[model samples]
Target: MSSRRRLGARWRRHRPLRTRLAVAASAAVALVAVGVCTAAFFVIRYELYHQLDLNLTQSATLVIQQHRGEAPGVLAGECRFQSAPACAQVVPADPAKDPGKGYLLPVSPPVRQVAVGARNGYFTNITLPSGEPARMFTQRIGLQDKSLQVALRSDAVRKGVGQAAGLLSGVGAAGVLLAAALGYWVSRTGLAPVARLTATAEHIAATRDPSHRIELPPGPPDKEDEVTRLAASFNTMLGELEQSVTAQRRLVADASHELRTPLTALRTNAELLARADRLTPAQRDRASAALGRQIREVSVLVNDLIDLARDEEPTPLLEEVRLAPLLAHTVDTARTHWPATPFELDLSDASATLPGVPARLARLISNLLDNAAKFSPAGAPVEVVLLAGELTVRDHGPGIAPADLPHVFDRFYRAEQARALPGSGLGLAMARQIARAHGADLTAHQAPGGGALFRLTLPSEGGPG
Candidate 1:
């Protein structure tokens, strides 16, 4: 069970991006380096061994020339030697005849025997006369009149080559260790800027401060490096986020300021109306009505503020709602409130359905109609049309100037000439918030017929068109 758990944990670790990348990079570099080093090491060893074999063949030829014409065929065990310990000790001066050829045998204790076969040369390791490790090489020669064979013991050369290989292996291991260390350090150095950027971004997220930006290290201004470009992009995002957050905070503060004034007025008007016994009935009624109207206006503004703030929370409550009936109710309410203005409704389908927040969606429609009625000339027609999930409200009044259109939804941004108008300048902003909450879209434009037109598009679930 413990082994199974360990395997499961390993699988989980292998699934992550950073772990996988590091493992793959390290394994690939190590494998390639080791493979190339091993190949080169073996190639050099093979070539050195081959050269040693060639030297052995040359030595055999020289020995044959020195012993030429001495014997047609001599047994290897009967050969005598006086000097040249390295040459005479390993190979007999004569060789025994075998299969029409003579093969040399070493008479020394370094090797018990040696026979030069007719095949390729090879080395055989054995104990020497001194009881030490030794190797023998055999070479055969066919002369014009007699065939000769020689054997050589090269214990020193074998030991030297073996030591060289061992040393090379040790060096290779050290090199692999050094390379791994250097590669890790280089990787860290190359990714240090990325790490810094990631750390800064994490700090900003924890603090919820969009003003925090990464400080780039001093270097040559190379924009081509990915790390440098990423740092620059992160800084740019912070700037934009700072501006957007500042704007939102300002909007909320301004909205609060706008609400405070209307609330103060409503409270004052209500207080005055409370002392109604001292005034005539007409005066009392007039004050009460004014207070009521002001209270209603204040209520609407507060609701608008709530609507605007709701946009900060993600995942609004959604429901499938019929569009035509909601529009009908909104228009009816508008007609009742502004009886002086003629209201018209032209819906393309009687049962158009869409996914949205029902209450916010209704409030958006109502706000558009209210805004149109307020701006339209008295007794003028306020046209309301719904076609293909798009609702357009147009008022036959002095349309908004093109320059002011862009700032229409800005909270409390009343036009210079329209500051005295009834609205606190948050209606359009509220309408836009509700539209966004429902995953729909809203825009304002000047109607071709010389009036302000507001178009509200309820996007399909497929996405915005």
Candidate 2:
């Protein structure tokens, strides 16, 4: 088969609902029309034949009457006349007188030879002189001396019946054509909404634009309708797509901003070290020390960047932590760095229980103490409190601005006072992350005595011992 033919056959086999609906509707109308027309054709033909028989009988009766009244000697042979109701069939007044004329009846031999019954109606099988198959009607007419046979050629009646049937068939075919056209148009109009939806979907696929939308025509809004629900679902999908795209763009922008600072610092320090040989001994020593410091800072920044990039969440591992001992250890380490800065610890009720990772909890406490020691003046005391399940660290240095408190735990974020400090901004952010992993909360606030207060709260049970 040709490609087009094969494709058409495949489509028919698939039989999509719209095409099937149209075909079925059209076929039903055609079948009903044809059936009704066929029945009507048969009924009309039967009635025509009945009326034709009555006409033949009436005409034959008139011809018999004329034969009885006519001048016998003058109209002896080949009698032919047209009168009321038109009489065509004629038989001689005496059949024996014209023996060569055969039976003198319109019907051929066999049926014409048999006399019509008392009922005055009989159909006969016959053959005309033309040798055509025909049916005849022969009826006796008049009374006593007027008695005669009348016959009619059945071929003529059959010809008329055939003509009627042909006409009905043509009319039926025309009706089917009209019905098919009507059905196609009605189906197309009814399915217009579906066509529009298909076109809109194609456009969406081509453009890949989630912002575009379809407008529904005015009607009663029903949630139960499948097409309406599909439109609603598509709109919801577009909303989620927009949110996801926006979030991705924001993340990219934030990552770019955070990477720029470390890169600039690394470049500046490397360029300064390259020019070290031309300087005097004292100047060269200062430059070498500055280069080492910058190198260490760059290394720290790079490590922190890697940590941020590889931030895999750890699974929760609940364990008891001893806060007082952990704080004392952290303070002892802080003293080596800032011995002049007074460290005061109050851990009377520090045995409160909490669920936490021990190493991370210790790191959280150490970061707070380190921040306090670095920011406070030499003689200023850094007060540490462990009460119930709460730990507080306060520094006498300038406190963080109230406006910046909310953003303290955000990655790579720092207040104005903390920007010149030695630590990266990620310290507080990391502390918060560790605290949250163990079902605890961490917050930054202002201490009453003009310093920053960092508060860490854990559950009473499974908290620090």
Candidate 3:
């Protein structure tokens, strides 16, 4: 049994989807067909038997009534002894006497079991003396000494039932065939979309093309089904994949370009150090310092690239962060890093708590402060303001160019005037990425007075009370 089940399961798994669907539908239809056919066959059989029994009862009653006034021997003359239409017999109460030649009925054990005083007529199966199958009913006549039996030939009833059974069997076979054909048609029509989807997926897999999309034909809105939704989801996934691939290519190209300058500088400085014996002590120190600066810049750039690439990693741990204290700590750290640059803070008393990763949010604030300080003139104070749920930073240096405003947050982007600055251009970009990861928005615009203003807006759920 277990082996058979395993074989059946393996067969089902290997079957095509459409064939399975057709088979399942056919099985369901076949079950209903079988039930209806069997019920109809039995009902027809029962009705045929009921009609035969009714005729036998009427014939038996008539025989008993007709012979009520006459002698029991009189009924023997009414029916022919060997006729197919009717046959009669008189069984005497005394078992010793035999019912003679006029009796056509074969005295079977069932007929002999009938009692003389039975109010309802007794029915039994009997064979006629002429060797035909018949249905017989026995009833007591007015004379107490004899019982009358009447029988009709059952050959016609048997023939009719046999014909009907054959007809039903044929109809049942036709119904099963029709059900199979209908199931095939239904499976084909219903799974048409699935077939198309499979073909499209196979084509994409073979060609390694993300640009190909599944396009369903236009149909009524009410007709939208699961297959349609699945196709739509597939197209959406393809679109995202295409965008990711394009972004990765761009990142590689830009990173190569950015690393080229620092790498060239390091090589030049190292060449100078190789000829250190021929150089003056001061010249050697200058070359060594330049090399150190280049090395630091490369390290910072590489770290920035790593951070940007990992922006889409799994979500970080979240906790309620108090914006006020976090901003104060970031300002102090920035002040320590650039002691020559003074920092001014204009913070409101309203305390805001936001759900975010503490380390990430701190990095975001530090980046904004560092960007402001990098562009600020020596001794110029960088201004920080936190009111409601918005944090703003302004640097009183060369403001961003109008054309450069849109691209400021783009990775490795720098304006003509800012290209020679001592920093990689990933600060604002990383800050914005962090902000977005925390469900916040960061934007840069020219301050009304004379510098660039960067605003970070937290979501309402994280806003001040």
lDDT digits (tens) for residues 1-465 of candidate 2:
699999978888898656766777788888888988899888987886777666556665666566654321222223222223332343333444434534433533332233322344465545545555444445444432212443345566677779878988998898799778866876676555566667767886898766666565666766336665666676677778766665455445655675577567657656766776766778767766766776776676666555555443355676566667877888888888788898998987766655566677777787788888888988999999888778889999988787998888876687888778776677777777777766777899988969989998876454423
Tens digit per residue, CA lDDT, model 3, 197-225? 78888997898778888877699856888
Work out the TM-score per prediction: 0.67, 0.47, 0.81
Q: Over 4 Å off in model 1, which ranges? A: 1-39, 53-122, 126-134, 138-150, 153-185, 202-209, 215-244, 270-292, 312-322, 348-353, 387-389, 437-439, 458-465
Lowest summed lDDT across 10 adjacent residues in model 2 is found at: 72-81
Segments in model 2 whose C-alpha atoms lie over 4 Å from true places: 1-262, 309-312, 316-319, 460-465
- Model 1, backbone clash pairs (residues 3+ apart or across chains), number: 10
Q: Is candidate 1 or candidate 2 better by lDDT?
A: 1
Number of the candidate with higher TM-score, 1 or 3:
3
Model 3: how far residue 148 lies from native, Å: 5.1
lDDT of 1 by residue, 186-290 (tens): 567667777778888898889988888787877787645887888888899899999989988997789778878878888887788778878899988888888
Name the top TM-score candidate.
Answer: 3
Query: What C-alpha lDDT values do all the predictions have?
Result: 0.69, 0.66, 0.79
Q: Best-fitting candidate, measured by lDDT?
A: 3
**Stretches of candidate 3 exceeding 4 Å from the true structure:** 69-98, 116-133, 137-148, 220-222, 313-320, 336-342, 373-382, 395-410, 413-423, 443-452, 459-465
Error of 1 at 434 (Å): 3.3
